[model samples]
Target: MSLVDLSWRNVRRNFRLYTIYFISMLVGVVIYFTFSSLMYNEDVVTAIQNKDNYGKIIFIASIIVFLFIVFFILYANSFFMKQRKKEFGMYLLYGMKERQVATMVFFETLFLSAISVSSGILIGGFLSKFFGMVLMNLMNYNDDISFAFPQEAIISTILLFTLLIGIITIQSYLNVRRVQLVELFHAKEKMDKPLKFSMPFAILSILLIVMSYYTITIAGDTNIWNDYFKEALIATTVSLIVGTYLFFRQFSGWVLQKMSQSKNYFKGNKMLWVSSLRFSIRGNTVNFTFNSLISAIVIFAVGFIAVDYAMKGEVVKKEFPNHFAFSTQDDETQKHIDKMMNESHPIIGHETITGIQTEKISNRKTFFSYPEYYTEEFYLFPESQLNAIVDLRGVGEKVDVEGVEAIVLTRGIDEPTKYESHQPEITVLDDNTFHVVEKIRYPLLSIPTNPGGDTGPQPSVLVISDEAFEHVKENRTLSSFEIYQIKDPKTSNDVSRKIYDIVMKTEGAYYSAYIDMYSIDTESSSLILFSVAFFAVIALFALGSVIYFKQLREATEEREHYAILRKIGVGDKEIKRIIRKQLLFVFLPPLILGLLHSWYLLYYTVILVIKDLPSLTTIIFSVMGLYVLTYLIFYVSSTSIYYKIINEKNRR
Candidate 1:
């Protein structure tokens, strides 16, 4: 037969086996295409305002997908070669040269590659549009977005797979050339068991896990300096991941052996399950290590995303005190504000616009070294509490002290106020009179704000007294527009609209503004939604890639074992059940670990992000619901692919 004819006939004969392999390639292609489409989306591009960044994301994602594909092809090619070894040996025995047999294998690989790559590209193109719509919905884009097939992406994907196929073909040819005919025929036989490790390794694994947990827990503590804590956490996490794989390698078998020693080994296919698990853990150390790392990445991403969403509300509320106007200093807007407020609703409280600017009077050499004029804790006290303090101090007259200004400092001022502190001994050079007044604590309406520098909002501090306010008029402007606190924040919008109309009617009333809670709430909701969706995608990608590769490796290892089982009269259905059960064990540990890790991390991260963390029940249920649904989908998909592989082998 011609080489092409022989390759075609072999493919037809083993179509089922090739079909499983084809599906995996197709899925990988679809995932790549979907993510690429999302990265290049016009709406997403506009949202981020960085189209070049999307290019980088696509390139990085493509590289990752390509690496996985290369690994998958190499692994599958190895297994397929091994499975067909007996056939190759027979061909050699029939006086066909080894080179001729190698040529046939090359042709077979080429044919399979062409069939799979073509079908995958087509399927991927269709799925890309669906994924685009899903992405747009997730991003809350109202604009029309039409999906267009990326010819460049398809071409690049084809080139990538072609390169991988060539590499696999050459490697397979080399592998076939080296093996003896006898060895090739006997390739299905089980090899000797891997040697057990010493007890020290087990002890080390436990220590690493403990140390990793310790690092993660302490990483965010305020007591630890940021750099030291981050470095330590990263090092410990890396060590633990390495240790986890080693533990699974040497200690997993020891634990399974112990489990088998007890009566529980007989329950629920425990023996089969344990054996299958042990084989998997022992057989694929690299896979397990990468899988654990990927799980960690997913958990961390989810935690970050959840915390980010939770904090969005607080951030928006703080950044914009009111929905319509963030800060207003215009005088003309004051009269318009009053008219709007009177026309709109019963105002709960009203205050005129006021501001203060302070200059250093003490001639402090360094800015940071100067004592804090006001601290956040002291500023949070309410006016009633401050009045009580004032009453308790019982100062009927201001105490005159030499060289020191007696000032009654009011708490909760948004900006710094200028005043020189006077000691009893020091005399002022300027003719400015000074009196020693007690600092009274008072609360200003503490808006949801962060006080930690530019990273977050800072609390406002005020030093207010009629006497002090009059003395500090060196360069101060009079307070302008009034603020009316409405009984309902919703009324602010209506008030703002009325004020806008009033200002338009009145001459020189140039700027009128009102802030409502609704605008802030909407902005917060949008931010939270985007954050949640962004993190979710990242988490899904990390987890899915890990599971995909793990399943691929596990399936490869079991191919020969399943073939041997079929030879020994084990039914194909039974083999598939074993495969399914094995996949369950492989998937469950990481899923459980990821969920637990995500839960703990999410709690702490959110606490730091949101001022008030939600109840434990709420957090737990939310995480559990998301995790369970995601896990179920992944588990079903991974196992289905695995069973398809096993069934194909059996039919062959």
Candidate 2:
């Protein structure tokens, strides 16, 4: 038979062994292709105002995904090559030339890569449309999306995978040529030892991870956060990654060693299995730690996106209960805005609210001496805001802040502690002295605030009575806002655009007065949410596939070990039990750790965004529950395949 024909036949013959590998590769390709489709989509590009920035982000993220895929493929191929060593050895023993055998590996790789690339592109083409629908939902947008065949994305996928196939082919050729005949025959039986590290280093690894978490939590409390937020982010990010790597590399293996050392723990199948697990060339500490880290990242990425997207909906509902808010000085401007909005949207009703804002004499005073680094500003709403606005919002109820009392509106877990000391005293505008009633969060309205002082609006808003507001109105500049409730929600964009044109093109429109809470139509918000979500999903699938295939690839090497155990008087039942335990041990660490990591992050996100956990807790748990089910499936499938391989000899 021709070498190419033989290789093709071998691929067909080993379809079972190649299934998971093929599936994962296909998934990776689909992810890349789908993303490419979005990246090159013209309609989407023109629609989003932040299109250029999004393109830059996609460019960077795509490179990351590409490099990651290459590494994953190479790593997976290494395990496959190990499994093929015996086959290669037998071929050489039967008088096949090394170059001919290597040529076979090359052909096999090329054929498989072609199948993966082609099928992935075909499937990706169909999925991209469905994905568009999903994106619109996630973004809370109401725009119709038509599916267009993405030629650029298709070409990109083809070229990328084709190049990978070429690289794999060359790698296979080199591997087969260098294979030592004796070593090839002995490869499966050989074991690999975990890397040795000192106790101090292990301790240091734990310390590093703790310190990294501390750095992230303490960032807001530091004076330098305003000036060095970007630097702090970079530093914290590096620390988190390096610390995780170090912990897994040095500390996790040490933990397993300690578990083994326990006299009571190591017995019967446990002793044998634990020893086997710790000593296996395939399940070495490095791979275990690396895969765990990958799984953790998958959890974090997915959770981050889920919470972000979910909270955005909450933000719009709570923060922007009204359709549009236009703050204008001229009553003429108000008329123009009203007409423009009415032309686009049938107005159900509108509210003209007046409030006092002070550029000067609007500072909040703290009672206690503290660090020099607190900048989440507290703003005032006139007493009329409580009876008129806050009453409508139904959040911060009138608390009888008659003369000497003020309530600090707490957002979430993070807000109550903004002050360094407890029971902070506040002197509003330094003239109205009020003892803190209690710090509480009331999401009465969603007005965008710049957290840092770089932006004028403060995050915290307090409500006083109309009497108190009227007293202070003359002291500060009076501003008015016309908040309109529109009947047709989908027409928000049209209304916003008309108002923008009026404010921009019309003569004598004040530069400072502007519209907000309406400018963010569903389409723009949906785009932002879906874009982040898509990146998270792509990362998650890629990482999950890698870990699953990594485990599956090792099953071939495990078969011989099970055979030896059965020969040494271990019953089939006992072997099966041992295998279950072994797999559970390997699976749980990464999965559990990743969940905890994601949980902490999600909580942090809630504090900043929605601030209330009860609102999003169900959704958060549901996403996590889905992940657990998916990862559990991987574990079960891997174990079943491994078990079947170990006992397949009995069937014969």
Candidate 3:
């Protein structure tokens, strides 16, 4: 048969073995094409706004996806070479020239790459339009976004994947060229990798991991040095990656040694299992370590991305309590604001819920303190007005501040100002001291009277009683704010945009203009949402496919051991039981470590930013459950296939 025909037959015969690897390649291409197509989609870019910014981001993301695909394909190529070494050795024994063997590999790689890439691109084309629409709807974009087939996107995707395929094919040929007769037959079984455990390294890894968490927890929104925040972020990431790797390598070996020393692990199947698997575990150390690291990353991405997605809306609501806020209520300006607000209301699919007007009784600075950290802010409103705007629910009984007493408002459950936690007294504008009697963890205003630099005041509004406010006022001119709240805000993107446009046009006329919650969903949150899905796809691809490749490779090397065990009068049931224990050993470490790593990170992160948003935790656990379900599929398949391969009948 011709080289092409031989290669085609090989692929078809081992199609089952090739299924996961093929699907992985296909997924990569699909993600790449979909991202590229969206980048080129006119309607999507236009509707989402930030056309140039989104374009740049999408282009960068597409490049990243392409890189991941190449890495995955190359990794899969290595495994295929090992699995086929015996087959290639057989061909050489049959007098097939080395050149012909390389030719066969080249043909196989090319055929498979071509089929998978083409299929991936085709599917991605259809998905791009659907995803585009979904993204627009997610941001509550009201524009008429039409979908069209992106010819350029298709061309770009095909060219990129084709280049990757060519590189891997050359790789396959190179691998074939290096193989010898002896290597093809016995190379895999000659494995002897030592388990080198370092106590110092393990301890160091733990310290580094803790340091990573500490860095991330502190360098959040409240950090003093904003410029160095990026440095802290990088340090945290590098520390985490290095730490997880070192920990995983040590963890696998450490478990084995402990099992050997302990009586609990010395009895029954544990002894047989642990003793038999020691060398196997040692040889697969790199694989297990990489799997744990990957698992941690996937877990982190899946967990926090869902948390961010859930808590973003709550944050938007807290940080921006009003749908639109205008500092000036000009008859002409208010006319403009009202016209824009009403005209675009239909487009945004929202109706006005309430409009709150507050006359700031002079720029009054409010100061509050905990032990070490003290926050100071400037705001002007009477207790009645402030309480009317913000629903201040106290933990204890709400006593009306009679005379000189004051009530403070702070957003976030992790707030230092929570009534149960803080005794925050306030002094307004540096003179009027009001003994703080109550605290409320509630929504408040975001706009500043003097919106200046990063170090400028991030003041919290103090709601003092009428008597205290009147005494402090002393007949000073006060700034004012008119905020409009809206309902069914998912449909309010257009209205928000309209108000922003009108207010920003005469920029000097207004103190600040922002459409609270939904505005962010359109611009910033859209990108974040897309990123979550992107990371999720990568995680799922790794969890669902890469494990299959690893298991199958190890299974081939382990076939003889299972056959021997079966020959020694081990029943199918007992064999299956052993397989269950073995698979759990393989699956549970990465999973449990991944869970702990993600949980630690998320717990610290949530405490820092979200404070009391329970939904964030709920969403994380929910996503984890789904991830485990998918992971279970890999475990099940690995066990079933391992059992099938090793249960070969002894014919001696």
Please give the distance, in angstroms, between residue 252's alpha carbon in candidate 2 and its true position after superposition.
6.6
Off by over 4 Å in 2: 40-49, 91-100, 146-148, 193-268, 281-283, 301-322, 325-344, 352-481, 488-491, 510-550, 564-573, 597-627
* Alpha-carbon RMSD of each model: 9.1, 7.4, 7.2
Please report, in order, the local distance difference test score of every candidate based on alpha carbons.
0.54, 0.62, 0.65
RMSD of 2: 7.4
Q: What lDDT tens digits, residue by residue, belong to model 2 across residues 1-652?
A: 9999998898888887676567667877877777678777666564444455567766776766677678767756766777788999999999999889878887887787889988888887777777766765554455666665578888878888888887887787778778789988987766566556457767887777677667656645666557887887787667666666666666666666776789866477777667666664235445555555655555555555556655555555554564655455367777766776677667776656665443332244442122122224444665555455555544445556666445555333224433334545655554765556555455333343211101123235555555666666665765565655676654354455556555546452222111233223344445554554555455455555555665565556677767787788999789878878877877776667667656656665454556564546776676678667767877787678778877876667
Q: Which is the leading candidate under lDDT? A: 3
Distance (Å) between predicted and true CA of 305, model 1?
4.1
Across 1-652, the per-residue lDDT of candidate 1 in tens digits comes to 8877887898898775566556555655665555555555554455332245445655665566566556655655665676677778888888888778778877877777777767776776666666555544543334455665566666776777777767877887788789898897776564436445556776677677767666667656756638576777678767777677766676665676676678878775567667766655655556555555555555555555545545444444443333232134356666556555666566555543343433323421111122253322212112232343234323222322222333333323322233447322211224433443334322232232211111112223333343444555455543233334554453354455555554445443223222333333443343344334444544454455556655754565567777876787878567667767777766666666556555555556554445565543454466557666776787788778777765565675
How good is model 1 by TM-score? Answer: 0.62
Q: By the TM-score metric, which is better: model 1 or model 3?
A: 3
Worst lDDT window (10 residues) for model 1?
449-458
What TM-score fits each model? 0.62, 0.71, 0.73
* Model 3: residue 622 alpha-carbon error in angstroms: 3.1
